[model samples]
Target: MKSVARKLSAVTLVVIALSNGATAFAQSKVTEIPVPNLVIYPGDLIEEGMLTQQRVLKRSIAGMPIHRHEDAILGKEAKRTLIPGHPIALNATREPLIVRRGTLAKLIFREDGLEIIAVVEPLQSGAVGETVKAKNLDTGLQVVGVVQEDGTLLVEGG
Candidate 1:
């Protein structure tokens, strides 16, 4: 009978320890982050009023760019559907597309304080400030350039 009582005591002690550990974990710090009001579809830019700060457990912040600036993430289009009350994960969104494939794009080359202008047909589509492939219409030479917000492509070193 005494042995059985000791075994029961040990189990009780283990359960108490586990409960205390869980309590400590629950009391850990949490932070508030911006979340959407509704399910945001892909390619929809996030607006300021669309999000509100929500308190979430610190563990959820892991693998997320929680420390990024508001403007850095705001106005970025969602790459996937974002559900309400859940913080948008980093890389879940991107800048809206500015250049489309098979379109004629103004290409600029900046070299040593000299600017050269040319027209190229883009072979691939890309968003503003993203690098994309474009082929020169005249020479048929393929070149890579960053798509500017003003529908211009900035090719480095011609």
Candidate 2:
């Protein structure tokens, strides 16, 4: 009778432990950091604390050339004021290319320019009008070409 009672207590303890472990695992959460006010299109050189506005007439005061537009720049403040150029910064929403030297990556061309896609190889250094070698991961083909203003590498072959 004592042995049976011990066995029943051990089973109850095991079930409770398993239930607690399952609850702890299921209650786990992922936290994401808030992005800053910066909008960077592909091929835009990013400086710290720089943002791009969407209007054509609203100029940049920080001597950085405006590359793209944002929705906030279309407000009444932009229309009413004839400010020569406001201080601009890059938006944090856009992800920058992470390229490394001598690593293989795939080049995807968009309407703006090109995007180099590689899981291991991040784009380290590239400029506009400069030729870069991009390799397709699936086909393993090497494509050489010019880097456009929109941050895309225009390969010679299709």
Candidate 3:
């Protein structure tokens, strides 16, 4: 009778353990998600809390299908996804070049139309109609223009 009781308790414990383990495993399954249409390359920013969908790329890392999410991943505070080719720039530096008023400059033709090539010199105190020459950085063409009060050079190039 004693041996029978011990065996029954052991069996009951095993059954309970198995039942709990099965429930946990079911909850841990990866959920199926949809794929996105946009192209996401490495070094692009990503953020969390944004919707994410998978993408079909020509090639994927480790044979895993590519996934894309909306918005850049919020840095450092979110869970990092180990997707290959996704690089985040933390602290970006580099100030934009600004052209001041009364500076001599040149215009160069570009796909976006004429752009300031360079500033020859900034305007001097009480200098009116300062002469400045600028060469197009892209086309190597030279242009001359006078600076205006709005920090823009008016150049007429052929």
Candidate 4:
């Protein structure tokens, strides 16, 4: 009977120690992250003024690409609905599309001091600096080009 009581005491101590450890973890360090001030729908642009700071448990965001800076999210379009006071995931937003699918844009090619410009219909839409496929309107030839900031496609080679 005495041995059983000692074992019970040891188990009680262990339980208490575990409970204390959990309490300490609950009060662990917090990180200040930016969150949306209101509901942000997909395709809506994120603005600096539309964000607010929130304190989150550090461990809760482990291995997550949560946005910590305003500059990282500013002027970006939301890819999913963002609720107020929730940390924004890095993949939740994207650069705004400068060129849309099936849109006619100028395709410029430069080689050996010669520059050639032609009209192209973008087969896919993309943002600046993104590569996409376009069809040359003049020659009906398929080509790959990088989308430019001005919504133009710049082709390389012939």
Candidate 5:
């Protein structure tokens, strides 16, 4: 009878321990966040098809990644390797580069029937539709221009 009582008490303790572990696990909340469906290479522009919503452990979000369905992710370029199933961090993306810094570019200007194109070099990098400063290589003039998709800079107020 003594041995049976001891075994019963041990079983009760084991049951209590199992229940506590289960309760702890159940208390942990799951968070929904955006994750890449495919590997996004560095400098690759993000598209809607490449992302999916996933529910993950709340504690797993250590770096404060971009939340799913919260912001527009398309048209952004990955600054680093983006792995599948991992949340895309806010710092991991940037605007796509249209004009590379220090690269030879053409400066275009148009007014009525007059159109001019000059050889210039960008002083800084910029994305399409963004304005950046370029140096006219021939005349050593600095001019600000809007970057175009074709990698040409259109000088403003021309």
Candidate 6:
């Protein structure tokens, strides 16, 4: 009788241990993450109204960089199509481009208290603080410059 009681207690301990492990596994398998409420196409700016939170299985999004909060997605431009009720990938969005291709932008060069400004055509679109290639309209030369906050390209030594 003592042997049977000992076996029953051992089984109970194993059951308790398994239950705890299952609970932990369950908690890790599911999480709440932000998802788009509507289809978001490339170049569309993400807004607060476009996002909603939903519980998602971790395995479904394994190895993907996903946005967990609505704040991370808002005010960003979509780089790829975002499907509704799915995880938003990190590479699927970007900062909105301030300088667009084929647009005229001011090119500013400053050195030793001297500044030269000229009009240039942007060959590529880029956001503030991004390097972009532009054509100097007056000289017809290709130049690379950093996009400034004021929609100007700042070129160094050019």
Q: Write the per-residue lDDT of candidate 2 for residues 55-121, one digit (tens) a residue.
A: 3222222344432344432211111212223433333223333333466444654344544443222
Best candidate per lDDT, number? 6
lDDT of model 5, residue 110: 75
TM-score of every model? 0.64, 0.25, 0.26, 0.75, 0.63, 0.78
Positional deviation of residue 5's Cα in model 5 after best superposition, in angstroms: 37
Model 5, residue pairs in steric clash: none
The C-alpha stretches of model 2 lying farther than 4 A from their native spots are 1-124, 156-158
lDDT of 6 by residue, 7-81 (tens): 999999999999999999999899889998999999999998898989888888778788877888899999999
C-alpha local distance difference test of each model: 0.83, 0.44, 0.42, 0.90, 0.85, 0.91
Q: Model 5 shows how many backbone clashes?
A: 0
* lDDT (tens digit, per residue) of candidate 5 on 1-158: 99999999999999999999998876666767778999999989888789888888777675665655535678888889999988777788888998989889988987776778999999999999899998999889898999999999986442
Candidate 1 lDDT over 1-158, as tens digits, reads 99999999999999999999998877675666777778899878888877777877777677676523457668788888988877777778887878889989999999989998999999998998789999999899998999998999997773
Tens digits of lDDT, candidate 3, 50-136: 334443332323244322223323332222333332422322211112354344443322334665445344333212255445554
Candidate 2 to truth, TM: 0.25
Lowest-sum lDDT 10-residue window in model 2: 75-84
Cα deviation at 133, candidate 1, in Å, is: 0.9
Report per-prediction Cα RMSD to one decimal.
8.2, 20.2, 15.1, 7.9, 7.4, 4.3
Model 1 vs. true fold: TM: 0.64
Task: Name the better of 2 and 5 by TM-score.
Answer: 5
For model 5, the stretches where C-alpha displacement exceeds 4 angstroms are: 1-31, 37-39, 57-67, 111-113
